[model samples]
Target chain A: GIQVEQSPPDLILQEGANSTLRCNFSDSVNNLQWFHQNPWGQLINLFYIPSGTKQNGRLSATTVATERYSLLYISSSQTTDSGVYFCAVGEGNSGGSNYKLTFGKGTLLTVNP
Target chain B: DTAVSQTPKYLVTQMGNDKSIKCEQNLGHDTMYWYKQDSKKFLKIMFSYNNKELIINETVPNRFSPKSPDKAHLNLHINSLELGDSAVYFCASSRLRGEAFFGQGTRLTVV
Candidate 1:
């Protein structure tokens, strides 16, 4: 099983601030995704970058598969962005179970207005 | 329309009771999964079904059973629920190797 670790277990910032959250895995992965668990407990897909970089509105993510690391960046954060950010990954060598995603503990972000 | 939806957004039951959570995906994905989020907010995979076939079953307890009637639906049943069973359960769907979409989550409280 692959292990995923998220950095800075907790983060707090004022609105309009920018922050970078990191995720490091112990093995190669074929699937990598970033998700935001809003205050209401809705898991919103942020990015599905197995490799390369992708940006969605004020959120962006980059995954370096070879290095087994990924970074999620939030620009000009708003109060609505406050919640838990999770990084989940699926091992490339899981055979028929490659679709199984192992999640990290997550980074708790709080953006104060 | 919701890509993935689950019934009973919240559930509360006494110990020794049996309850089931239903999940359906309109995205037509082949892979569906059940994940549990504990009180501390740690998320872990419990079971996964691909194309209506069970593929991944983590070290979950026997009390937790997951059934997939088709590629678009997966349901979870818990027998004799205990205090430890109280947590948020999430249903998700995705392509064989694509990004996953999660439901709003069912928060279960076992009294």
Candidate 2:
């Protein structure tokens, strides 16, 4: 089993602000993803960065696999972005029986208008 | 159209009741998964099916079973549900990729 830890378990930000969330894993990962769980309970895939950086709209993600850490950044945040953000890491072994992903506890983000 | 969709947006039942949640995907994916988000908002993998075959079975309780009648569908059945079974259930689909498309969750409440 792999251990994933997210920082700043709870975050509060004013609308239009920018923020960065970090996820650190205990081991190397073959897959890394950032997800946003909206108020309606839909898990929206934010990024699929096992390594390198990716950007989409107001968000971006960077995964430094060699350092066992990843980051998600939200710019020009909106109130609708308030919810739980999750970072998950799949066990590095793609050929093993444990291809399951281990998720971090999540960072609860609150956007204030 | 939803890439991944689930039926019964909300479920409420008695402690001893039995229920099921249905999921479907149109992304032509070969793998599907069921995940449970407990009260603490912790998402854990319950079961996974690949091409209608059981591929990953976590340490889920025996009362929970997953059935995949075809590549596009995977349903979860719970028997004699307990109060602790109350949570949000999410359905996700993916192939040999890192990202997964998730359906709107089904909130289950046991009284």
Candidate 3:
């Protein structure tokens, strides 16, 4: 089993601010994703960066597979961005079917207006 | 639209009852999974199915069973539900080694 740890378990920011969240894993991963759990309980896929960097709108993610760490950045946050952000990782195996993903405890973000 | 969808966004039941949550994905993925978010909002994997076969079964209770009739569908059934069974259950699907897509989640309440 892979161990994923997220930092700053609770974060609060005023609207229009910027923040960064970090996730550290104990082993090399074949798949890594960042998800935003909105207030309505929908797990929205933010990024699927097993390695390298990716950006979408106000969010961006970078994964350093060799270092076993990943970072998610949110810029110009809005009230709608308030929710829990999760980072999940799946280990690499010879079978080529890593069906299970290990999720971090999540970083609860609260963006106020 | 091509997405992963689950039935019954919410469920309320009494102890000793039996309930089931169904999930389907049209992303042409071969793997489906069930995850439970407890009261503290800690999400954990309960079961994983690859191409209609069980592969990853965590230390979930025996009262909980997962069935995958096809590569696109995976359902979870819980028997003799207890107060501790109340939580948000999520169904997700992914390719053999790709990122996963999750459902809206079912919030179950046990009385």
Candidate 4:
């Protein structure tokens, strides 16, 4: 089994603040994804960065597969961004039955207007 | 249109009862998954099906059963529900080696 840990379990920011969320895995994985679980419990995909960096709107993510870690960046945060962000990864070399992504506890972010 | 959808946005039932949740995907994806979110918001994979074939089944209990009719629908049925079964369940779908899209989630309350 792979161990996934997320840093800064909680965060608070202003409307124009910037923050970075991190996820570290105990094993190597080829499938890594970032999702934002909105207040309504809607888990929306933010990135699929198994490696490298990607940006969408004010959000961006970077994953270093070899280092077994990934980062999610939120720039100019907004009130709507107040929720929990989750990082999930699937171990690539764990033999069979390792196709599912193991999720971290998550990072709760609160943005005030 | 929604990529993934689940039925019974909320479920409240007594212990020892049985319930079923329905899921469907309209993204033309071949793989679908079921994830359980506990009270503390920890997400864990329950079951996964690819192209109508069962694939990933975590260490979940046997009381939970997943049924996939073709490639577009995957349903979850729980027998003799217990208090530990109370959680928010999410249905997701994706293509092989692609990003997954999750549904709105079904909140189950086993009283």
Candidate 5:
């Protein structure tokens, strides 16, 4: 089983601030995804970067598969961004019976105006 | 339209009772999964189904059974629910190697 650890268990910042969340995995992964669980308990997919880097709006993520770590960047954070961000990864080849995502405990972020 | 939809946004039942949560996905994905989020917000995968076949089953109890009648539908049934079974359950779907899309989640409370 692959172990995923998310750093900065809890974070609080003023609106418009920027923050970086990191996720480290114990083994190589075939799939890695970043998700934001809003207050409504909806797990919104932010990025699906098994490797490399990607950006969407004010949010971006970079994954170094070789190093087995992923970084999520939130720029100009807003009040609505206050929630739990999760990093989940799937180990081994993608299509096997043992393939399933293992989620980290997550990082709780709070942005206040 | 919702890419992944699950029925019964909230469920309240007494101990020893049985309940089921229904899920459907229109994303044409090959994999569907059931994840349980405890009160502490720790999410764990309970089961995974690929193309109507059971692929992965974690160390979850036998009281919880997941059924996939087809590629687009996966349902979870719990028998003799206990207090420990109370949690938010999320249904998700994705391609073999793609990102997963989750449902809003069904909150189950056992009294």
Candidate 6:
């Protein structure tokens, strides 16, 4: 089983601030995903970057597969962005059909208006 | 339309009761999963089903059973639910090594 660790267990910032959350894994992974669990408990997919970089609106993520690390950047955060950010990784021989995703404890982000 | 949806967004039952949570995916994905989020917000995979076949079954207790009738649906049944079973359960679906979509989550409170 692969272990995923998220940094900065807690974070607080003003609405206009910027922040970076990181995730590190202990082993190689075939799938790496970033998710935002909003205050309403809806798990929204942020990015599915197994490698390279991807940006979505005010949020962006980069995954360095070889280094087994990923970073999610939020620019000019809004109050709606306040919630738990999770990083999950999947490691197994069956591509993704039968593999299970192991999730990190998550980074709790609070963006105050 | 919701890509992944589950019934009974909130469930409350007494101990020794049996309850079931139903999940369905419209994404036509072959892989579906059941994940549990504890009070501390720690998420963990409990079961995984691919093409209606059981694949990954974590160290979950025998009281928790997952059934997939078709590739698009997966349901979880808990027998004699215990106090420790109180948590938010999530249903998700994804393609092969693709981005997974999660349901709104079913918060279960076992007394």
Q: Which candidate leads the pack in lDDT?
A: 5
Give residue A85's error in model 4 in angstroms.
0.5
Which pairs, if any, clash in model 3? none
Kindly list the per-residue Cα lDDT of model 3 for residues B28-77, writing each as its tens digit. 99999999999887899998888898888888999999999999999999
Candidate 6 or 1, higher lDDT:
6
Top of the candidates by DockQ: 5
TM-score of each: 0.97, 0.96, 0.97, 0.95, 0.98, 0.98
* Candidate ordering by lDDT (highest first): 5, 6, 1, 3, 4, 2
Better lDDT candidate (2, 4): 4
Give the alpha carbon lDDT tens digit for every residue of A21-47 in model 4. Answer: 999999877689999999999998889
In candidate 5, what are the lDDT values of residues A1-113, reduced to their tens digit?
89999999999999999999999999989889999999999999999998999999999999999999999999999999999999999764644656788999999999999
* Deviation from native of the Cα of residue B49 in model 3, angstroms: 0.7
Mark the regions of model 2 whose C-alpha exceeds 4 Å error after superposition: none
Off by over 4 Å in 3: none
| lDDT, candidate 5, at B42 | 100
Place model 5 in a CAPRI quality band.
high
Runs in model 1 lying further than 4 Å from the true structure: A92-95
Per residue, candidate 2 scores C-alpha lDDT tens digits across A39-111 of 8878988888899999999999999999999999999999999999999887635553446667999999999
Docking class of 6: medium
lDDT of 3 at A86: 95
Superposed by TM-score, candidate 2 places the C-alpha of residue B58 at a distance from the truth, in angstroms, of 1.4
Q: Answer with 3 or 4, whichever has the higher lDDT.
A: 3
lDDT scores in order: 0.93, 0.90, 0.92, 0.91, 0.94, 0.94
Against the true structure, what is model 3's DockQ? 0.76
Off by over 4 Å in 6: A94-97
DockQ of each: 0.77, 0.63, 0.76, 0.68, 0.82, 0.79
Q: Candidate 4's interface RMSD, please?
A: 1.9
